[model samples]
Target chain A: MLSVNRINTYRIPFTFEYYRPRTLREALEILRSVEGAKVVAGGTDLVVDMKFRRVEPKALVDVSKLEELRYVRLVEDYVEIGSAVTLQELVESEVVRARLPLLWEAVNSMASWQVRNIATIGGNICNASPAADTAPPLLAYGAKLLLTSLDGVREVGIGEFFVGPKRSIIRPDEVLQAIRVPVHPAGYGWSFRKVSRTSFDIAKISVAVLLKVDGGRIRDPRIALGAVAPTPVRARSTERAIESLSLEEALEVGPRFVEGDIAPIDDVRSTAWYRREVAKVLLRDSLRTAYERSLNPGWVHEG
Target chain B: MRVRLRVNGSWVEVDVEPHETLLNVLRDRLRIRSVKYGCGIGECGSCTVLLNGRPVTSCLVLAAGLDGTSIETADYLAKTELGTRIVNALLLEGAIQCGYCIPGFLVTIYAALKSGMIRRGDSTEIARAISGNICRCTGYINIVKAVRRVVAELVAIGAD
Candidate 1:
């Protein structure tokens, strides 16, 4: 039996220098100077990797102390969220809940309240898990990410952020600064549905839909699915197909197009066959709900 | 690295390795028994603590970064009026099985109820609020019943 005291020293068997930068500029400088350095925020994901020796770093740049990157504010037509803002803070923010239901619902369906308190949205995005619950919603919302480096800031749409499973285009010297979710026009309806082994577990399959119903026809639909491909992807082919059909016809024929756009594989959480079938059902249901909310403008006030 | 933390209203400073977790610092150095190591990952809430008044898994938090933060554990909370009421309710409802998960449950419950997320007679919300902790022995029914009972009394007396 292991002594209770062993849990402390058993963590991270390797030694590494830790840097907690006080300012964003200092953080960037450390990232630029330190070789084999990794940025940690919340430390919920990176620390776990270190514990299992999945990743080993020579220096860890702590971005949590950079206060400039911890905020959620409404500026003009979008809600800008700092990368260091915890998932719990997003759940508690009025701007996120009121204006970004697609993003809001996904955050709520994630790990327990305890993990959410320490997990950052930026970490979720940069980790680039295929089953990232926040990705589908952010993709559906057409959100934008601001990556900061000493060179300056560059904007990348969320859809273009991920390159592969657990991979992204984030440069070594840059940090994800803020996420901008557009305060969509009032006529849109949003739905985010995730299915996991348990409510707190990683997503087996998830879908987010942002639909507009105008005069009984679906227009410019944005559908995103997670845990179906190497990366969370927007179903553009499905959207183009749905937009050309009436709401009733699309509800009947739309889900099939999702199969063409995604290639789910069998994994520990679920089988590819099961994911394909269940994803169709979720897409249909989400479309129905989103259609209803689009017609009933009163649903906009539901916070 | 040296980290300074305020635990249960008392400030203490300790030397921590860069990889040392807050869970290690509290349990080994501070001898705070409220936290336990059920799982090194955040899946199990047995290592839960209140960081700046919000419930978080201490095992996932690096101690070196928490230089001047405040922490609250079940060790300090078990003495308060609300904590006493929660303990009595758990006992009254026969929620203890092995009693190993009780401290983690108590800490999660205290933070949720104190924050007003769990309301009177709302069993579903109560279960969701305390879902962070996993109890391998006692099923959650009696535990949910205990929280419901605590909320009812707190409401009746107009206390939170």
Candidate 2:
């Protein structure tokens, strides 16, 4: 049995250099110079992993104080979210709650209120966990990640950003500055579904769907699933299979198409069979909700 | 690293290692024992504290990152009128069984009531607000009752 004192024993059991850069330039310089420097925005995930010895960087660049990386703007065709914006800020934003209900749902279900207060979207994306709750929604929305460094800035499509589980294409010196999410067109319906061990737990399987309906036929359907693959992936085959179909007809063929898109595996959270079954149900449920919501946008706001 | 922060309304500076968590600094250096350490990971909310007026698990917060922030723990809240009201309600509801989780729950309840996200007698809101906190002893029934009672009292008195 672990002693009581051991509960807080790892609370700084090791030592490493720390840097708090006031400006983005300074942070980038430190990252560029240091061999094993990690940027800590919220430190919610990084700190815990460090305590568990899962990661041990030579230095930590604290960027939570960089005021430049904090804003939420609705531009002409996109919603630009500063990567440092906490999940709590996302939940509190009326624009997010109204204009991007799918993203809002995904963020709201990601973590508890307390954790949400400190966890940032940048950290969530940079962690690149297959079970990341925000990934599917962002993938469905076709978001883009803004990566900045001493060199300059570049934008990577969200789909291309995540390479695999616990890994991404993020350069060692680059910092994710903001997430640019395309605003959904009017008359589009979207839904997000997550199956977790508990209400506040990480997801075993999650799905996000966005589609438009005209004349009782689906159009431009998009589907994304998380935790069932190495990276959150768009269900292209599933979307193609259900295009131009009525809600009833789509539901009939959706589950089979989903099986082709996702590759589930046994894990501590759930069995591969359970994930496949739940993924099918979630796909159907999200499709039904999206279909119903397409008929009435105001219905999306309803409880 | 030399870090400075306002803890419980007092500005203090301490040298903390890069790996040190805010929980370690609070309990070890500042001697704030009310912030209990249940699970070092963020799963358990035993080390919850208010960072810049928002409740967060201090165990997950790096002390080095809190260089210029403000933190409030349960011990700090116990002095306020709202904190006293919550404590009385907890007592009335018999929420504290083993008392291991009381400090964390009290801090969480205080933040919830103060944030205005929850209203009086809304058990659903109360539960949602504190869902991150794990209370093994009481099964959360009495704790929910206690929070509701405090909310009702605050509402009746017109305390915003």
Candidate 3:
């Protein structure tokens, strides 16, 4: 049954010029020429936002058809995923499930299969939502983004990519081309946790943790929290508190240090207080599970 | 803009607006009614269709971006024998209440069965495959049963 709201209709409220570029160079050229042009990969977020009058770009350059940005490959010491690689492709890749399990987990925790079929990793990051499921995992994994423009290409660390909610350092003329995620060494445990209203709903609080445990003591743990601040942020204080401590010891003290890392605000989905409280719980759970996975790399944990 | 794509095995060229979704082009321009519009957003599965042999929400897809792509909707799919069998199985299992979401589920099941991604009678796999679709009448139990029924038939006939 369709719930038709008078205000929110299927019709896109505004008209915009559209371009479907076949190649990366052509797409970049269109971006450079068209003033106030926005790049649409999946349109899972941008289309809905347009219907709601959240963003009204003068034109849209559709890069969904560009073959240059639709791949997932291992190059050198990193796994490079093209920005246009769909979420469904990420979920079906055995390499992603094996090498980057947290990334797989984050993709699984995202929207439903229908949405995943169209949504791309590049679109998720470029959309720059604070609760973008892929951001926390990329942040913890120390991934770098490849941004391309007519002038040249530049790489930006994932941690510094997002400037604010719905904003990133991406220039109007540049497009996110690919994401380079460093391959983890042995004995590294990774876990991603997302708290949402339903399996398909957006996350209220999501956390991803990567830890290396050696001989029962944690080493250089990294924590990333989402939907708790203006942008997905790494919890350095929490990581420092848990570093060099046993799993049990970290669980006791690490959560307390998270308060200094996140600045949550009340929204329609949840309250700031609730987000703050759950952030700690999720951090503890992620840390414990990550430690367990670190001990046994063969362990399989579903998102 | 003039966009050209293959729809249900036929080449289609249409003049469409930049913001026009594939759902509108299919239903309004081509008269392909199997792809229903629901929740206009990506949340509802009523508008599910096969894009390049993969299941996708047609409502979220812009028609202008689908140039040179292949799309399949249930309306054209029902011409095939397997599609007809699946439709019959749904009625046998009493899974067609209200009938709005049936087209999406059928198209998704068709794609999943063709892809060979799920084992026969694996309800968990089947449920996960169709998790994107919403049946507001709460007819999921029977819908799953209907899919299982079709799978059993396909297995009996030794169809891949």
Q: How far off is residue A121 in model 2, in Å?
A: 0.5
Score candidate 2 by lDDT. Answer: 0.88
Query: DockQ of every model listed?
Result: 0.70, 0.72, 0.78
lDDT digits (tens) for residues A80-107 of candidate 1: 9999999988888888888887788889
How well is each residue in A81-193 modelled by candidate 2, as lDDT tens digits?
A: 98899999998887788778899988888788889998998899999999888999999999999999999999999999888888999999999999999887789998999
Tens digits of per-residue lDDT for model 2, B64-92: 87878899999889889999999999999
**lDDT per residue (tens digit) for residues B1-160 in model 3:** 8888899998989999997898889999989888898888888789999998888988888988887889999977776887898899899989988999989988888888888755666888898888889998955999888889988988999877
The lDDT of each candidate is 0.88, 0.88, 0.89
lDDT of 1: 0.88
Model 1 residue B14 lDDT? 94
lDDT string for model 3 (A1-303, tens) is: 565566554778889998888899999999999899999999999998987888899999988868899989988788999999999899988768777888998897788887898999999999999999999999998999999999999999999999999999999999999999987656799889989997889999999999998889999798999999999999998888888999999999988999899999999999999999999899889988999989897775443
Better of 1 and 3 by TM-score: 1
Q: Which ten residues in a row have the lowest lDDT in candidate 1 chain B?
A: B119-128
TM-score of chain A of 2: 0.96
Considering just chain B, what TM-score does every model have? 0.96, 0.97, 0.95
